[model samples]
Target chain A: MDVYKNLDWEAVEKLKISSGSKIVLKRDLNFLRSEENISVQFLLDGEVKGSVDCHLCLDNKDIDENSRNYLYPYFTESMNILLGRLISTDPMLSALKIKLSPPKCTIYSKTIDSRLMSELVVYSLVINDFDFDVVLNLNLTVIN
Target chain B: MKEIIPLSELRILVVDDSDFSRSMILQILSEAGCQLVTETNSAEHAMKLIREKKPHIVIADIVMPEISGIELTTKINDNFDNIYVIMISSLSQEHVVLEAISSGASDFISKPVQKNQLIESIQKIAQNISKE
Candidate 1:
């Protein structure tokens, strides 16, 4: 089968992650080519907030939950790659004010903060029994 | 006879704030038979390495702590007369690219460095070296 037929870009957002690469996933096409990971709402420029959350599968079967923390940098680099694809495909945004702040990672907790409400548009995919998701929670803005 | 420079013979420095990015770039360069490649997680350290090792090419990320890639490029332009800077970033905005070039980048590549893309860049730079 031709894998090229399955690869194409849809639309995407140009948001940023805390200390991560520039945020570029805003739609289905771009997300399809990207790896899985998480992005929160604290990074975007406007009052419109929420995170571009991503899900990715680890290639190494050796990593268990205990060593999962070791994969943090990988996930960050993956985001950079994904964002690069979007930018490469779209050259028009080069002139915008396009301010980018440093990536700010938040520890997961049980409670939702003030600016982010949980309005979610979620998509899920499973390949070879490994599942992935990319979610955009617009109401899920972050305060930072 | 005129001499030719291959990617393997060139000295390179990979600069980024992320450890994974540095490792990933390093892996790609190494796989392409690059012999002299060094990596630093920040632009500050990049300057020191540039002065010490004097790599022919500097592949750098734009958004970084302490020093952004544009500033670093400016520094290189001012002090380092012979080094070529390649700007890499997740930010694809037009203004950002222009800023990088104006600041002294010889070329620009977006993040998520692909092997072919990098090799092609190295070849282009190597060709320029041969020409000069």
Candidate 2:
């Protein structure tokens, strides 16, 4: 699968987080797309309430390489760092409830690790600041 | 620098299907002072080792072929005693959470596994095991 479909530059531009706000990034595997979708949310007082989507793509060929070993982990850890940044920059999301779901898809490959999949979603949620009661509706497929 | 106890001294087993996940956990545990950490990519091997070695703790993924973490925990509890199992996964679904706990897991840690979170959870489990 071709990983990089297209960067949503418009979404990136729409980010309105202020300076020094805390951000939390999370990633969700869209079983429909066979791709990982990243979300960046802002955090305040350990709550995520606001977020922006940060989509990442990976080539199927890369999955064949040793480099793929770092793909999921790096994506996840980087998002965590970004979340820390959002927390420092914008704390407004501390009180708002946030909800997120993976793109619609019915059939998902179960060969992938669940933690890897969750890392993808968590990475997406790391960049934006949001509140505590936000609901993250995640859609996952178990492909055998 | 935090004066935390090292994990290397504790016997740890990492169970996951992916080489990357196993390696990542191994690295993290090693850095945390785990010295006798073993890695298994399949639940079958993991269960076999649990029955034989009886490590201090088992860090296992939830979804796997042959035997899932829930089943493994159940079998371990049925056959052995005093082995701590920590279920790790990306999904925080209520059903899975309940199953892991019901299956004799000490705790469930969500993924993507944060270094601090994993360390803290392991430390807590270790402390509990020591108390027993």
Candidate 3:
């Protein structure tokens, strides 16, 4: 069974609504070239083994201090909510035991090198007229 | 009528690696009339604070860098009595919840925690503490 197929898409839509953001699926990896990015990764164990990397695209915009304070935590919590919903709400996934490590955040001063990565998913979203991107790199194994 | 434990009287400690989560939890506790609340980003520091503050409830995130929340719960169970742990995490699989419960967590809460759920859990535990 395809793990992606079993994901709870309604959760994704809920995420957009809760964040008050409009999301567009981006086919290219251009979001990786942003000047600054916040990357949060979770380590999965149990029935699923691997890591899920969620990135927030914050380019060279002059964001104010208030925006920075709000956006960072908002983005982190959004990732947590999305991933938690993805695993716990899905019929197939909820039945299987899985552990997600605490999401770890890192800020990059340069563009991410996507050429070396495989199985990348990108979502470009606009929240309050400020553009942000969510990049997911799933390297997973589902134990039968 | 449900006996309302004055949240302000319950000393609580919240441990999470995410600044966002910690702040959100603190805000919730504050609004709910909780007065004594302490927070830490690492489980390592949480242990020291637990020793120092001796809070009635400890809200912990399951995932962390040095020591995971499960380990922390186990440690608390071993060394302390009546220190209820509320485990919070993004993963809600059956085994994960079971593991947390087995590790001595008084309650389990999923991440992006709902305010009512957290308060309810805390209230339940606080009431239990009052009984003992």
Candidate 4:
């Protein structure tokens, strides 16, 4: 099964409702090295097992430390809501019994860990005029 | 005049690993006129706080590091009385909701919780608490 094709973008679009931000899909991987990025990984387990990583970048360079700290959690929670909606609302995902782990945030690094999945290509999600890059490293395999 | 639901009188405890989720929840509760609110990052610590704080309501995230909210609900049901558990999560699957209710949660709420929904849930519980 084509994982990306089967997945529902509408369910993921629930992020817009949660964050009160409009999301636009961008083809370019426009993440800048100069800007500090926040990344978090949510581990998925069950018949389909793997992980989803979200890398978020802010447009405003002048944001203070306190604001950055606040946005970090907001980003994680936004993704958490999106993933949960995807699992529950998506017809394909809801049929399967899947368990999602709590999100584990990591220090911002430009490198994508190749050991998990080779699809380093990211879908840039522009939210509230800021760029949010989502990298899905899901190792999709049916476990019997 | 009908007696108003004393949302301020109900002590609420929020348990979630994400600082953002907790802050959002805190802001919602505060805006809803709830004054006595306590928050914890882990279920283990939540259990400890329950012993000391004895909050009337517990709003917990289903996904966590050490112990999950479901396990915490079971613990609360086994040990405590007159305390209600509201299970909150991004995983809003029917089975997950059933599991939460079966685990002894009084209510289940999906994430990005609406302020009105939360307040209604709390109000229902508050009314019950007032009667007791």
Report the number of the highest-DockQ candidate. 4
> Candidate 4 residues B8-33, lDDT tens each?
87889999998878987999999989
User: Model 4: residues >4 Å from true position, as ranges?
Assistant: A17-36, A58-62, A112-131, B1-5
- Candidate 4, overall lDDT? 0.77
Using lDDT as the yardstick, the better of models 2 and 3 is 3
Q: Per-residue alpha-carbon lDDT of model 3 for B1-96, expressed as tens digits?
A: 455457888899999988878987998899899999999999999999999999999999987777999999999999999899999987787788
Query: Candidate 3 chain B, which ten residues in sequence have the lowest lDDT sum?
Result: B123-132
Residue range A1-144, candidate 2, lDDT tens digits = 111122121222122122322223323343423243332232221123223333334314234445434444444333333333332233232122222211122222223233443323322222233221111222222112
Please give the TM-score that candidate 1 achieves against the real structure: 0.69
Between candidates 1 and 4, the one scoring higher on DockQ is 4
DockQ each candidate and list the results. 0.37, 0.03, 0.44, 0.69
Q: What alpha-carbon RMSD in Å does predicted model 2 have with respect to the real structure?
A: 12.9
List TM-scores for all candidates, in order. Answer: 0.69, 0.51, 0.81, 0.85
- Model 4 residue A132 CA deviation (Å) reads 3.6
Ranking by DockQ: 4, 3, 1, 2
How many residue pairs collide in each prediction?
A: 19, 64, 0, 0
Candidate 4: residue A140 Cα off by (Å): 3.0
Residue A9 in model 1: lDDT: 38
Instruction: List the lowest-lDDT window of 10 residues for candidate 2 chain A.
Output: A1-10
TM-score of chain B of each: 0.93, 0.88, 0.94, 0.94
Better of 1 and 4 by TM-score: 4
The fraction of reference interface contacts (C-alpha pairs within 8 A across chains A and B) present in each candidate is 0.67, 0.00, 0.72, 0.87
- Looking at model 2, residue B113 earns an lDDT score of 62
lDDT by residue (tens digit), candidate 3, A32-123 = 55557878788878887888888787777778888877887678766776777678877777888887776677866546656656676677
Evaluation by DockQ, superior candidate among 1 and 2: 1
Candidate 3 structure lDDT: 0.79
TM-score of 2: 0.51
